[model samples]
Target chain A: MTVHTQHINMTRTPLPILPISLGVLFLGTAITMPFWGQAYWLHEFVNISCFFIFAMMWNLLAGYGGMVSVGQQAFFGLGGYFVLAMGNLAGVSPFIGIPLAAILTAIMALPLSKLAFRLNGGYFAIGTWVIAEVVRLTVANISIVGGGSGTSLTAFRGVDRVFRQHMTYWIALTCVVATVALILLFLRSKQGLALQAIRDSEVAASSQGVDVIRMKLAVYVVAALGCGLAGALYFASNLRISPDAAFSVNWTAFAIFIVMIGGVGRIEGPIIGTFVFWLINHYLSDYGTWYLIGLGGLAIVMSLYMKDGLAGFIHRKTGKDFLSIKRIYRSK
Target chain B: MLLTVENAHKSYGALAVTKGMSFSVEEGETLGILGPNGAGKTTLFNLISGDVSLDSGIVHFNGQNITTLAPFQRCQSGIGRSYQVPHPFGNMTVFENLITAACFGGQMSEPEAYDVAEEVMNSMGLTSLANQQAGSMTLLNRKRLELARALATRPKLLLLDEIAGGLTEPEAQELVTELKKIKAKGTTMIWIEHVVHALLSIADRLMVVNFGEKLADGEPMSVMNDPEVKRVYMGIEA
Candidate 1:
């Protein structure tokens, strides 16, 4: 035993200096994009960031935590409405309101989880959608926020157009970076291990002393927080908020599509999928119904041919994870 | 006594699985349990470990009433259990599985858990399979991983449910040798097994249970020879 102990050790391989340096270089250039890049490109990036963050949250919930929630847009819609409420009612700047709106949305998830958690498997997915619809209908009846027709974010009315666009762009960039960094940290933590174990087998995890219910609830709330943050930032850029746009089921559909094509359990899945989704939307969106059909067909192909998605396929081919969180045993 | 179950009763509606069963285990004692297919043996283990809650009764662990504690809480309070059929976290490597049991069940920090996991893997002859995904392992290896995980918890009491149920004679003897090492360290154990010869080799005392009732409990040979035990468990006409 003593001899074996001397030779065996477990470790998380530290991030290589190469990726860190490359990441820093890319981020530095991106931070200065407003000075040299076109406004249209900035808008595109803001849109991509929103999709990436939202999809990442969905991946964390379903891919890692074994929770398949299709109603996350409830929090998204709530975030949109909350920011507008803060600006229209309390006169808070939309900039300040966006973060607060996200917090309020996270708090809302606690009670919502109580109801949603009562159902499991396919029922859970449907239950969340029902909850989202309930939230949307409830918000639509409130006249101050334009009811169902929605209203503009008037708080940004006085702010310079160029300045607002630049700040919004920067905020979106920040959200993407922060989301990636934080999720990476979480997946490497002990709680992250617990979450994955629960995902694999709740009974086994519980027998191993993991508080399965608590871990699931925590992941649910965190996912809601991510969705809310993305929603608020998204509408902040678009300068409008309405029940139909804010609570649209298409938001979740796009997120699910992105995660499925990219890879369900890998961090790179959402990032890669968002890029692919952006390319398709940018190039083929004008085709209308055909574009939607193409997406559905692509998702089917990906599921059938590449069960693990694009990132998983890439890993299988190259034997490398661009962003790995796996812990390995090392022999000294 | 290190553990005590008094009138433990559990049922699934009209079907009574454990009917007012009671027993106790002293510190460092290995109690071998013998029972027929539906004799509520596994159910008793569940009741003690808090996997299945008692319909009405009391469970005392280390002199503390723990009847209402959750399964995780029972584990935290120095109880460790292995399933009837091995239940490894399928996608995770064996080392990750052991680290989880040590970190959560034993309430150890990451570094401490890693060290314990390493030692357990080595002792269980699983160091070579540390990086192997648990679900991909053979049945015998899965059983070893299951026991290794339970040991990683550093439990004051270990509940093993048919750890050797499917092994060949040589394999069962190899496991007995491993279990003897654990016993030498004075850890209390309650092992449920149909491998009578294996049970006879290590169990300090033997117990026969039928329909959730204790038919006999005493020295190994005497308990095995009890007329009631033979008639019921061994299926010999009295």
Candidate 2:
């Protein structure tokens, strides 16, 4: 008689040294950009970082939570208005108002999700847009925040231009880092697992004892918080806020473009997609309408060929994930 | 009784799916439910698991009234179920699916859930395909994964809805073997199946439902020989 033993080795590998080292090298360059880089580069960094944060939030909400919202600008606009109101009226620093706006936006999201969650699929998308339009019109009539005419951020009026630019640049970097870290930590947690299950099938998730409604609501409010933070910081850097620009559907459009091109579900997709989007906008802005046309064409091609986005294509080819949450198992 | 359904009623606008049907199962007993198409077998499972709201009456599990509990709450309270059509989380691996059930439904911690998932996978003959994406699996594997995932919830009572519907004879026999092992471990079960031979092999008691009403209930062979059951299955007066 022969005896055989079967053994399975299931372990989570340690973080890859190469990617961590390369990531550190990139961070080193980014942190010192203000010292050696041109002012234009710093300004662009702030814009890219703001949009990156916004796109990340949208990706989490739509990709992970299965709540495809097209009206995230509702929170974005609200954040901008909140900061403007605080800076101009209450004499609070816009920097202080930025965080405060995020809180307020999250509180507002609680009620908004109730109404928005009632609709699913295409109707949900349209419903959110309608809500944003209502918000834009209401803000337009609020005369207190300059209404339709809009208002400029006055909290930074006394600060020097050099100091202001550096401060804004640092704030943008902080927000981007925080957003990525928070999401990475979240996606690695037990609750994050539950959220992904809910995304796949709400019925199956509930059968597994996940509090489906609670998980969805949490993701919705958290996404709103990130969006609000980005909106406040973006306008703070621009030093201007108007109902049209703040509440514009273009914000959501740009976010969708970035998420679609980079990959909707994966974390690294937004980072790669945002940079690609920024580069195209920078180089092709001179072409005016042709730039928009080219972007539209590229999006269509990407969707048809690479449904998972650029990051997904890269993953398929290289079998590497810069930000994967999937667990690995091995047998021996 | 481990599970008790008392005169539970349900309707979908013009259609009354469960017409005040009542039944109960003791702990560790396997109750086999045989029903014709659209005879409210699945609907009965849905009511017990809180997937559908009952128009009236109550459900008691482990001696507590669970009529008002949510689907998830029922799951947490030790009632687990498998769907007629598998509902595996397509993006997740088979192991992750079981982990979700263990962590949430079984109310275990992360490490504990992993242990439970591994055990369930091994017992269900799913250890070889643990890392496979559930959506890309064969129908047989999907069915096994569904049952494994539900079992990972550590339920006191398992409600299986047509788990044997689409399996080959050999595959069905293999499942029967696995299920018999689980029965030996003493988990209470209520299985609604079209496969009469498979149900007869393990069920201690047999029930027949027709037009949302209990047509017959007794021992497996006796229930099969019942004239009304013969009439219902034959669709003619016996």
Task: Residues A1-332, candidate 1: write the lDDT tens digits.
Answer: 12234334556656656766878998999999999999999988998898899999999999988999999899888887888889878899878887888899999999999999999999999999999999999999999889889999888877898898898899889889999999988988889889878877888888888988899999999999999998988888887889989998999999999999999988889988998999999999999999999999999999999988999999889978888776677644
RMSD, each candidate, Å? 2.6, 3.4
- Please, what are the lDDT tens digits per residue for candidate 1 over residues B1-238? 9999998888999989888888899999999999999999999999989889999999999999999999988898899999989999987889899999999999988778888998999999999988888999999999999999999989999999999999999999999999999999999999999999999999999988888788898999999888888899878987
So what's the TM-score on candidate 1?
0.96
Best by lDDT: 1
Docking class of 2: medium
lDDT of 2 by residue, A1-332 (tens): 11111313454434556866887897898888888989999999898887899999999999899888899999999988888899899988887888998888889999888899899988989999998998899999999899898998887788799978888888888888889889987987789889889888999999889999889889989999999999988888898989999999989989999999999888888989999999999999899999989988999998998999999999989988877677655554
Report the lDDT of model 2 for residue B205.
Answer: 100
Name the weakest run of 10 consecutive residues (lDDT summed) in model 1 chain A: A1-10
Candidate 1 stretches greater than 4 Å from native: A1-8
